[model samples]
Target: MSKLDSLLAIPVLDRSNQPRIQAAVDGKAKPPRALGRIEELAVQLAVIQKKSLPSVRQPQLLVFAGDHGLTRSGVAAFPSGVTVSMVDTLLAGRASANAFARVVGARVSVIDAGVAADLSDRRGLIHAKIAMGTQDASKAPAMSTDQVISGLLAGADIATQAIGDGADLICLGEMGIGNSSSAALVIHRLAPAPLEICVGPGAGHSPEGLAHKHMVLAKAAARTDAAEPLEVLTQFGGYEIAMMAGALLASAKAGVAVVVDGVICSAAALIALRLAPQALDYCIFAHASVEPGHRVIMEALEAKPLLDLDMRVGEGTGTLLAIPLLQAACALLSDVADLKDVLEAAS
Candidate 1:
């Protein structure tokens, strides 16, 4: 079978231990459910890990970089060249994501999924370019089905490598100019939502710019009726987005929690979850993006993000912020004393 087929066929997360995990959380010394979502997060981690006491000691944050040709249609306020510059910044450890990763104690790795420029000489950048960015979807399909499969395999390898190197958690991030536009089309098709509701101001567009972007994306959306996850992705998804979807699948197969960031990453998650619905059991939606379309996608996945910071800056910034919460949840599950133990000690 193809690699994508193998990934899709991987067994869903085992839940036989879920009741045990929940009981362990309820047995914590804190008032029952007082910890709220943190308690829920702890249970999820334990169930994903198949351990009553789970810890996220080795967290890896992967920022996949690519470029979208849709920018050629004036769909974005920023030029597409910014994608290359940001990839450099990420590799140089100067981007906001790097700074946040430092604070959160996550090792940041940047992958060149499909940047529209040659970056083969960059040190410390994972080279997995499927193409020099995708083609303009408004005019034609962004990429071929084979390209999507290749991107997915490359991404799955990256995640598997990180997990092999001891990553207990993976946080998804992306950098690609006009990628939000690509993500909008993907969400529009997969969420089965109206194209108008799926369009949003990406990177702060002016009134006319926003209208133009919406128009261009609508044209792209109209070009295809692919509701299948892979087909929709092939028609409109970015290389980084496809890679992120593959990484999500690999992480789920290996039983690692993935903290999905922002609207772009959420679009990736939509594709991953659509392919294997059980992958949601392994995903932790980090935060809601300022992009309005994010809500539509989140609703499609039946997911509520842990945070709603009015932040639009992608590159896994939200994922970094959510790591501490995951760590806290693991601590609650593993470090907190049992109610009986606490009461016995008090007596």
Candidate 2:
């Protein structure tokens, strides 16, 4: 069976411990439901682990970097060189993802899934290059079928490594000059929203640039009627986006929680969800991005984000911010004692 087929075969999160998990939470000293969304997060952690007390330890953040041929269509304001340069920032521990991961005590790995330029042998970089970059989807499919499979497996392999290294949760992020455009088109096929609502100013595009980006994305999406998640992915997905989707599936199969970042990450999540609906049971939307269309995708998936920092910078920033909340949720489960302890203390 294909790797995706194996992911499809995995059942939804095991929930036999739900009652025990809730009882543990209720036994805490605090009033019921005081933690708000965090209570739900704790419950999900337990369900994924099949245990009443759950903890999110050694979280892994994988940032896949690629180049998009769609950038040649004048979609993004920045040049393609930024993809390679930012990989340097990540390796040097200077990028936003690194800072956030450091704050949350998580490890970060950078993958060169399909960057157009060559990067030096950086210690933290995972060299999973499938091609120099994706083809210009405005003229042809973004990735060939073989390229898609390669990208997907590369992502799954990273998750395997993280699991082997003992990560209890994973977060997905991306770096590509025109990936936001690819993500927009990916959404166009998966969810039926107006073409206008699907476009956004990624990495700071001016009004004219945004309009041009919309036109480019609309034309790119019009290139295909293939609505199957895989087909839509190859038609408009960047290598990083496709790989991130694969990682989501693999992480779920390992019974690990996946903290999904902003709009681009959400687009990848949508693709993975299409492949295996149960995968959603293991995912946590980190935040609602500044990108307007992110809300549309969240609505389609019925996902409520953990934060609303008005963030759209991507690169897993939102996911890192949400980690503390997950940890707090787990603390309530693991650290808080039963009501019997509370009453005994009072006596």
Candidate 3:
């Protein structure tokens, strides 16, 4: 069987430790449920790991970079070349994601899922390009079924490698210029929301530019009638997003925590969750994006993110910011003493 097929065989996370995790969290020295979302996060990590005390010591943040064909239609405020430059910045460890990784003590890696430029010479970047770039969805299907499968398989392999190298937690991020438009379309179809609701100003767009983007996205959406998750992804075409989806599947299968970043990453999560409804058990929605469509997708997934930072910078920046909370959760569960134990000591 193909790698993608093997990843799909992942069973739903076993919840046998549900009571033990909840009991452990409640036994913390704090009052009942006083820790709020952190407690919930701790329980989630525990359940995913099948242990009452979980650890987030080793985190791998994979920033999948690609180019969108929709950019050629003036959907983005920046040029598509910016995607290439950003990939180079990531490789040089000069991007904001790199800085954030340093601060959070997480390892950062960039993958050339499908950039329009030739980045083969980049020293540290992972080479897994599915193509130069996807076709313009406004004119044709963004990718073929085979391309979508290949991208997903490539992503799964990258994620598996990270896990094998000691990544207990994986965060998803993406850098693709026109991908916001692609993400919007993916949300529109997969979330079953209105096209207008899914379109937003990505990477900063003027009012007129945003309007033109809506028009272009509408044209692309009308080009295909694919409502299924994978079909929608294939119709919209985004190598980075597809790879992110693959990574999500692989991480969940390996019983690791997956920190989902902003709208684009969440769009990829939607595809993965649709394929394997159980993968949601391993997902941790890092933060709520300022992008309007994000709420729609979140609501569709019935996921409540850990933070509402009103941030829209994708490149896994939000994920990096949220990693500390996961660490704190782990500490709260593992390091803190039980309330009864503290009381006995006091007596």
Candidate 4:
């Protein structure tokens, strides 16, 4: 097996970790009541007849923006300027995510995890910059451990506060040039797969550029110890990815459902799962991305993505689009009429 495979071979927890799951589920559990089999069937019948469950009271979208040093190595098709521009677009309510958030009634919040350009601390922006930019990973470590830890802590704190602000559902998105490379590194470290299986043409890279990206990432991995996954993230992952991972952890801890977008967000989810396997119970895979490696990661997580719009955008667009489906799932469980209700209507 390859070194990447061996790293992923490390066994984490399995289904036996019900205590953690119970902590999340029982956090809001009520006392059990006695019921006859007929009554049990009646409750199930009622659920089928209703076809909709209790509405999710509050949903929040957390967008993390950063800059990747690997962009300096020409790994990404888009320049770092796009990160700042997109942040402005998001703030102006003109981005695709903004439009989708409006459709779902989700509150949006943006965080400057490490954008290279300066953003004014205005309304709707969370000032959580860890560094102006990560170090050039093509040459050395992308970020120091202190910066990564700080970013993670900031993200966790923000998520906890959002939960306290009455957010029951959390959607994760990211903005960072060359972030796909950082995601690939994290995926490589956490997944039982080859680097090539986890690398893809991010932001429309040409074949040659994609090859260069894979080579640089492989060399970087060779220089690092895969045994320490968080160390790999600190050294090679994007600040936004690190922060998003922490947000996933916090959401799990807070008993909120987390919706994960495409590949980059999936990478963050993988890292979070690595840290706390129970976190997976709270995550819903949003969509299948066009990126080549995304499927492999999804398979490793055993996640069935809700949609396959061929989207590769990292600004939480996929997650935003998938919100309605979640609503529909709840609706099906609570609102749809069952056979008994139909027979009664016929009578």
Candidate 5:
């Protein structure tokens, strides 16, 4: 069997709490605002005032990088060192995300959430480490509840500050090895889907490696207590994921648009929706990733992803790609000559 097939073969345990399930299922809960043709026309009208008017402020990209203890168990196809290496590549402007962000005219900020390696002297990186790394989910809890809350708060604070610094739109992304396992655990808790549907071949794992990952995740899920969102996050979630969730909430509260990337970011978005369903008003699903479970999460949230380029690289590449589309949307709404205006001129 392929890696995805083997992972899907494992039975999913019911680890969701009643309150969360009820809240997620409750239709009376504030229904998400679906932007249809009329809403799209309205958004266009609001922004397209005049060509001479200043365009909306430049978008900002926030990339959160951390290390997952699950990597130590060979659950991932890439080594743990890749996490630090990718951060360096990002700093050096050599990563694919950097190139993509530059093309979209978005400024990228890299936050060191909790990479195991020291990045103390990195000049441009944001130092927001909550711990050396998250705890191994296979043997014990991923992090303390307090730690998870702190990480989330810190991430939100960063996004708030970025907006204050003149950012109008926000794109959420992450970098971490073995994070897919953490994402799977979070999705399982938040959505109550089959384990196979929640899990995917992160970074290209072989069949045996993927099966091993599924078994470890199944064991972790079995041991977790699903009483509350925070408790479940502490039990089996990654620090970066929790922080991204917090950032999403903060962006909504701040009234800024948030573009969500692939599966990992979608996990965070799911948590954000659970914590504050109103936050959905400020979100835009950027893309559908090659990861099998990403589409499932997107559907659950009723999110219509903007792009589907088979992108599985995390670091906000998909979100960055969507920035130009958003710019075009705003431009078309505000700049195009209306039929009335054209008729008046002709007359």
Candidate 6:
């Protein structure tokens, strides 16, 4: 079996410890459910790990960078070159994600899933490129079958590496300029919702540009075979997106928490959820993007995101910002004394 198949073949999520984890959280010195969503992240982490007090200790941010051919079709305001430039900006640790990662004590790694530019010379970039970029979905398939497998394996390998290297949790991020358009189309198919609901202004489109994007993406969505995961990938998904889907599966298979970002990542998460429904057991939605499609996809996952800041910067910044919440969740249960323990100690 292929790596992707092998991973998915693993048993569904082992939520056998659900009651114990919830009890542990309630038993903390804090009142029942006092930590709110922090407690929620914690409880879910415990269930995924099959243990109470699961640590968010070695959090790693996996940022998959790519370019979209749809951008050339005037679907977005920023030129595709910005994808390469932003990947470099991210590698320099100056991007907003880096700042947020610094605060959460998480390591950030960028994967070149398929940037149109050659970043081979850039130090510290993961060379997982499937091609220079995908074919323009408006004109042809977004990716080939082989590219699909390659992208999925590349992402699976990254998540496996993070787990092998002791990463307790991994967050998904991306840097493809026109990928918001690609993401919208994926959401349209996977959400199986109305195509118009998924369309959104990418990079602040002008009225004319927004209308053009809608026209292009609506056509793109029509081309998709939404019922099958791989078919929808070829029809609408980008390399970064395909890779993130793989990452979600690998993380879930290994029983690691996957912190998912906004709409683009949500698009990938939607695909991953389709491929492996139990992946949601390992996923924590980081935020709700301003992108309209995000609402539909997030609803599909039945996910309550950690934040709803009107943030749409998509470098996994939302996931990075939400990392501390995971940390706080762990601390709340692990570090805080149990009510009975405190009471007994005071006697």
lDDT of predicted model 2: 0.87
The lDDT, on a scale of 0 to 1, for candidate 3 is: 0.92
How do the residues 1-347 of candidate 2 rate in per-residue lDDT, one tens digit apiece? 86657756767677878888787777787878887788888888988978777888898899999999998889989999999899899999999999989888999988999999876467768999999889999999989988898888789889878988999889998888988888888887897577688889989899999989988877877777878988988888989998998899889888888999999999999998988898999999999998977988998999999899999988898999999999999898888777788889899
| Per-residue C-alpha lDDT of model 5 across residues 1-347, encoded as one tens digit per residue | 83212211322222233333222222121233232432342242232221222244578989999999888777889988899999999999888889998888899999999998899999899999999898888888889877987877888888889988988788998999999988888888787577788899988988898999898888887886573667777887887898888788776666567889999999888887776665675678888998877977887788788788999999999999887777765554445554455567889
The TM-scores of all predictions, comma-separated, are 0.98, 0.97, 0.98, 0.83, 0.85, 0.96
- The TM-score that candidate 4 achieves is 0.83
lDDT of candidate 1 vs native? 0.92
Return the lDDT, model 4, position 344.
Answer: 70
Counting clashing residue pairs in each candidate, in order, gives 0, 0, 0, 8, 3, 0
| Candidate 6 global TM-score | 0.96
Task: Give the runs in model 3 whose Cα sits over 4 Å from its true position.
Answer: none
Q: Model 2, residue 225: displacement in angstroms? A: 1.5
Q: List model 3 lDDT by residue over 268-300, tens digit each.
A: 999999888889989999999999888988999
What overall lDDT goes with each candidate model? Answer: 0.92, 0.87, 0.92, 0.76, 0.77, 0.87
What's the CA error at residue 76 for candidate 6, in Å? 0.9
Worst 10 residues of 3 by lDDT: 2-11
Error (Å) of candidate 1 at residue 158 is 0.5
Tens digits of per-residue lDDT, candidate 6, 1-347, equal: 86768967656777678878888888989777877888888888778877667777888999999989998898989899988888888999999999898987889999999999888899999998999988889888989988988898789999999899999889999989899889888877777788788888867888999999999987776665556888889877899999999998888888888999989999998998898887787889999899898999978777888899998888899998888788788787689889999889889
Question: How high a TM-score does candidate 3 get?
Answer: 0.98
